[model samples]
Target: MVSMSKDTPRLDPAAIVTSAMRIADAEGLTAITIRRLAQEHGVTPMALYRHFRDKDDLLDALAARLLADIRLPAPTTAPWDEQIRAVLAACLAVLRPHPAVAGLVPARILLSEPGLTLVERTLALLDEAGFAPDQATEIGSQALCSLVTLVATEPGAATENTDPDTRDDVIRAKRAALRALAPQRYPHILAAADALTLCADRDNYYDLGIEFAVAGIRGIRPATRTSG
Candidate 1:
């Protein structure tokens, strides 16, 4: 650990957030305490408290930072469904790398500028799709929730940071366990053991989710109304 000195640079809000994210990424969100962050940054806990009133305040800032990292999809002339998919895909790209934040974001009401910006852009896309204000709001809420669910429940989701060898061992164990089931009693599990253990590749997994969401949204439109 680097020792603090008289010449040590003063800690700033951005630096605090950055260090917090690093710790969360490496050791999960629960490990990100003010003391831990201060220790990592070679500062005292009081230094972090200067910027954030408490752990919740620090977490709120961390959530904002995660949202800020997401690059919003560029405006395109594509159909609204395509635009929605693009927006969600961008969100997934940002959240997947920081899976810990994926778990944290949904629990908090995001009042930060970056979080509000994402919500604004999403609502705008829904508006462009011709939904009424209330419908757009509901759809936007559902879409965001779906994005969180996808990251939270997807297989191997929680093991992203685990050692490759350990992950492989877990997968192998699951596959073997499924294969060991009685054929007559658990025929489906035994038959598809390989598929049960392996997860879809990232693109396929995300694309399927986007397609499902878009299809559901499309289904809600009046049958006589044609999509552009």
Candidate 2:
């Protein structure tokens, strides 16, 4: 099949993965299958198998392609916080762009060159920001994984289902169910029901998280240095 590469007019793997991602995003991951991908491309199933051995191979390929698009910007000369913010923002944009893959991201084990590049870039950013190697790895892991978790749990396209009204109703209902609890045992929660029911603006929440993380890192750095 690879020998056919020149004459067969190779289908762009990146394009195939983009289309597949759209399907997964719209219909859920289970809807992604070799038959479906072939149909989407107007190609024979045999052609797809030539490109990817199976669904797992396709998934791995898709992840690597997605990561490739997110090459980290150089952090040279920028304040550490801004650099960190850039990384987080870039990562969020990349993951959010492929909502289907957002759910699968946390489970991904780096198996391709692009994936390795991403890991290296992340660690490099943390190291630049003055974190010890171990600390950098830990922080990078938590931040990147959290971005996937956030996007997967609250995908932009699925906002209607997770709207504030629906969320508040569920929370209130849960609070009401706890009515049987002795007031003394849960006094604070019971008293703060109204405050707890208040909804925070989603954009602000995202910004706040980024801000908090950057601030925490800055606080930990030495007073004489502002290089991070």
Candidate 3:
């Protein structure tokens, strides 16, 4: 059977990936499929197959798109610590808006040109801060995991994705459930229930997560040695 209509816009990797991301953001990653995207675009699975061999390949393309959006910082004279922190922040900025697909990044970070560049730059900074090659690679992996997880687990993520009034209701219901616990038995939980349920300031929450990640890299930096 003929796959594409004469008037259908020619599908490309960029168009396919962008549509998949839109579906992922609004409906979650599991909702994306070659058939689903093809239907939406008035094309056929065969047309999409020209760009993505399967769902896994399409997801890899999505991951690469995320990496490509990262604005890697220029080489700077600043301390490695400062520059590394900036790199982490840049990655977060790109991934934060697409938490649904942010998790795809860590597994694919070494698989694309942009991702390879990011990994190389990150490893070089770690080396500048005194980590050996192996140590820097391991540390970069850990940092990648942490940054992706940061966005993926943001407080009330799915609920917060709703309309404002609905989101507030979800947050309030969660807070009430936590606060309803026996104060005497759950005093500490009650005390921090709001923070546990939701972050009042989204930017502040991310700022702290970035600082925590940076502090972790610094905390483990190699120490000066002395003569035995």
Which structure among the candidates has the greatest lDDT? Answer: 3
Q: Residues 84-124, candidate 2, lDDT per residue (tens digit)?
A: 88877777777765766765554563777766777787777
Look at candidate 3 and tell me the lDDT of residue 172: 92
Candidate 2 clashing pairs, residues 3+ apart or interchain = 80-228
Instruction: Residues 1-228, candidate 3: write the lDDT tens digits.
Output: 336767777777798888999999988999998888888877878888888889999889999999999998898999998999899999999999998999999888888999999999998999899888778888889988898888888888877568999988999999999999999999999999998888778899898988998899999957453445
**Candidate 1 lDDT trough over 10 residues, lowest sum:** 219-228
Write the residue-wise lDDT of candidate 1 on 1-228 in tens digits. Answer: 445679989878998888888888878889989888888788888777889999989888877877888888788899888988888888888877777777666555357777777788777877777776678778877877787787666776566677999988888888888888889999988877876666658778877887888888877762233445
Off by over 4 Å in 2: 1-10, 106-109, 155-200, 216-228
Residue 207, candidate 3: alpha-carbon lDDT? 89
TM-score of each: 0.86, 0.68, 0.93
Model 3 bad stretches (over 4 Å)? 1-3, 221-228
Q: Any residue pairs clashing in model 3, and if so which?
A: none
Is 2 or 3 the stronger prediction by lDDT?
3
Determine the backbone clash count of candidate 1.
0
RMSD to native, candidate 2: 6.4
The per-model lDDT (C-alpha) reads 0.78, 0.69, 0.88
